[model samples]
Target: MSRIVILAEGSFQFHAAKTAVGVIRYSKDTVVAVIDSTKAGQDVAQALQTNFGIGIPIVRDIREALPYQPDTLLIGIAPRGGNLPAAWRWQLLTAIEAGMNIVSGLHFFLSDDEELRQAAEKHGVMLYDVRRPPEKKVVANYTPHRAGSHTILAVGSDCSTGKMTTMLELEQTARQRGLNSAFVATGQTGIMISGNGLPIDHIICDFLAGMVEEMVLDFCEKYDWVFVEGQGALNHPGYSPVTLGLLHGTLPDAMIFCHIAGATTIDGYQHCPLPSLPEMIRMNEDAVNWLHPHHNSKVVGISLLTHHLSEAEAHAEIQRIEQETGLPTVDVLRFGADPLVDAIQRYFNA
Candidate 1:
């Protein structure tokens, strides 16, 4: 595994710093340090406001992190447009010149950029643009759906509201109970962690569902349960299509609706307040049923991201969602995923 320094720069928050957040939660590799001048000298736990067990330092720049001897500098902020920020160019070049490989989740391919690519080559370092879609020759065509294949997708109220986190915990808890489980990654961070899965958001809109269907079908044979990591949100105007496509493609037997505890609106769209929990639930079930009328899929549980709340507040919110939606609800990270896993087993294990 690589020793990585995450470059979140000025944008390390719950909203824009999902890549960094994902790594802190679930990287197989060692995150030696993080770079964000704004929060320099703070430990990652303090900076992110959540303890991820390891004490990762936040340094001012690449030069400060050189002593850690990191092999890779990971671009750890997934900004609105997925473009490399102008402010990051020099930091990127400096890391490449120091012979550290670059792994970026940005849609802006660092490997395709002439100056950055040449610098990497000169230093004998590699560049991995994780969000770059595979060549057409390798992208999968839609496959026939299998019967009795249990899949549960983690759809969300907004982007970066713990969809991947929920799916991952569900998989972990399922295996702890001795069930065969598989996780299908749908984004670059998930791909980085799982070492498998296509970056579905990078695929063209036309092939999105087909690619997702192919991914689900591939995993159906080996695992008793397949947990598809979802992207974006159904209520997000910018990303609803991707959410809809994934919903149809996975055709999950169950769904976990993910949401942040106090988020009233889409992160970037404050004017567009989130749908009521019941309304969101209705929309998801309607979308799934519309996609596959004969298949009766339902929202099995709610995976609320409660990292921002107090334990008492988290529990209170959990109870509220359960009562409101009449479904099991949990903060899968703060609380174990047992409740949601029990819901899944109850619904699908029969």
Candidate 2:
């Protein structure tokens, strides 16, 4: 396993640097340090206000993180378009010069970049682009794959709304209950954590659903319960296609709607307001029905992201959402995924 140093730089919040947070929380590799100038000289868990990376230190740059002897540098900045920021070039160069391999999940592949490529070649380091799609072509056949398997997909109100986190937590809780389960990663962060999954967003648009369907078929054949990770948002102007593709591809028997507790608009695109919980639920259900009329998939639960709320406030919000949606709901990371998992178990049992 690679000894890693995460480069979050200017973006190092729990919600902002999800790639950083996910790696810190779930990766098997050792994350020696995080490069965040703003939060330098602080504990990663303390800086992110989470209990994941307890002793991991936050430093100002690659040079500072070098003392930890990290052979790999992870670019954990998740921008709107996944573009490589101009300011981060020097940091990558510095890491490459120090003979550290670079790993990035951005759409902008560093290996394809001429300057970074030449520099990496000179230093004998590799550039691993996690989001690059496979060369093999695939297209959707829309074959229903849920004969003896249970497939669950997490749909979100907006991007970075905790779909991956919710599904991961749910999978962990399900395994403890002695159920045969698998977490099907769909994003780069999830792929990095699980070490095997196609980046749903990076796949070609025409082949998106087919690739997802292909993956789901493989997993359903092995695991009785397949929890496919979600991407983007169904109602989002920027990322709706990938969500739609994943929904159709996975053919989920049930979906858990994910949303940040007080969010009224799409993050980053604040001009686009979010729909009510009920309306969003209806939208996803209708979408599934439109694609596969015979499939009985519906939004079975709500995964509320209440990290922004206090404990008392979070409980109140969870209660309110449960009352509002008339479905089991909980903040997966904060309160555990028992409620949502129970709801799924109840649905399948009945």
Candidate 3:
């Protein structure tokens, strides 16, 4: 049977540990052990029993856990400002040396760490950052035909909070406006759709740069509107950095930022502390400043993905953000299609 080990730092004890356990269980592979020095000697089985109800021992050190000879190692160590911790790096290197495949969610794994990536490549060990899937094969000859009055609306958040659903809703909303819109999966979880009767390639792999340019050009030429979704979490490789980078030179006429106001989003903002609200606000402002100035693009509006907030609470949050940023905000669920179209029209007209 295949076996896997999990290593996590103190910072990732709660969420990362839980995620690691789920991956192991879903893989149908035996979980050899969990290594958390702070929680050493504690029964991994009992510690995780509350969450997973499965018994697995928690060991103090990698050496102690190695006797089981795991086939894979999942690292759940917290990133140090987007970089891997030295201890975690050492652990990964050791695991690779031991001939175990490594998978991690650390952002540094997607960085310019040639040594780390090359070492794993040399060992023929697969490393999945979990933020972005490995690149896939692209179709070389596929080219999208230009359509008249077609506008591709691409909306992305700084993170991964309800991006998929929001994009889908935007598609439906566009259809109500008598405009043809389809969802394109630029990231790992996005759906594939045909454009102008041609099968569009996956955004992340095939035509990331080309698609952005082509879509923008197509929007200028053919379709009424196109809606592209953005994710919430910035640390993930499949998030907006790449998409935004591709849009640097060729930006759409307008863009919308989606903000989620739910329990998950609140917890993500508060406890998880991936990207704080203030930081995100500042980031969006910066992005707007750059695009608005350089590319002559405008921030059309902001959409609230209210999964849990009451109408009053949601409006209050939107009001606060609008007052601070001086930008119009629309509660996607409450405003329906008219407000969205108005926002799009106002910005495009400006």
Candidate 4:
């Protein structure tokens, strides 16, 4: 396992810092430090406002983190367009000069950058582009999910709305109930936690659905239910393609609609207001139906991320959503996933 020093820099704990937070929570790689100049001299827990139960220092730059002896420098921020910022280049160059390998999930491939490429070659360090799709030619083949595999896909109102977290929580709840279930991780965070999964967004659009279909089919014989971790939102202008592919590919029986309470718009796109919860539900249903008209998928539950709200406010919001949608609803993390799990069990009459 590589010892990774995350370069989150200006974006720690914010939406852009999602990849950083994921590594902090799930990476098997030793996370010696996080390079966030804004949060320098602070513990990661303190900066994030949640105790990770581990000590991870936040430093100002790569030089400050060198003492921790990280072999890999992982870029943990996914800015819009997946472009590497001009300001971050110097620090990244410094890390490469120090013989640290680079790992990035951005669409802007580090290997494509001449300076980064030459420096890495000079230092004999590898650059792992996590989001680059496989080069081999492939075709998208549609197949309905086989019966008896009660699959649930965690579709969200917007990107970074806790789809992965909800899926993991549901899977954990299933295990505690002694039911046979498996989690199908489709992103970096989920893959790190589960130790295996395809990064669906990285794949070319033509093969995205086929890849999901293959993954779901592979898991069917082994588990009674498979919870697929959904990607971007159908309403998200930037990431809707991957979202639609996962919906059509998995063709799940049920969906747990995820939304961040009080979020009027997407995290970065303030100008683009979010559609109503009912509309988001309809969008997902329409996508699934368009792919598999026979598969009558419905939103079975609502998973709200209420971390920004007070406990009472969250509870009230939960009640409001339940009353409005006539669906079981809960904040998966604030309260245990029991309500959501019970909702799904009730749906399947388990």
Report lDDT (CA) for all predictions. Answer: 0.86, 0.90, 0.54, 0.85
Residue-wise C-alpha lDDT for candidate 3, range 127-233, written one tens digit per residue: 76544433443322323325333233344444534444455556677777676655444433242111121112223534454545554455444455655545333
Taking the tens digit of each residue's C-alpha lDDT, what string does model 1 give over 48-138?
7776725889999999999999999999887767888888899899998888999988989999999998898899999998988877623
RMSD of 2: 1.6
Model 2 lDDT tens row, 54-105: 8999999998999999999998878878899998999999999999999999
- Candidate 4 lDDT, 181-292, residue by residue in tens: 9999898667755766788978878888887888887887788889999899999988899898888778888889999988889877989999888888888888887766
C-alpha RMSD of each candidate structure in angstroms = 2.0, 1.6, 10.4, 2.5
User: Lowest-scoring 10 consecutive residues by lDDT in candidate 4?
Assistant: 136-145
TM-score against truth, every candidate: 0.93, 0.95, 0.46, 0.89
Question: What's the lDDT of the predicted structure labeled candidate 4?
Answer: 0.85
Model 3 earns a TM-score of 0.46
**Candidate 2, position 205, lDDT:** 88
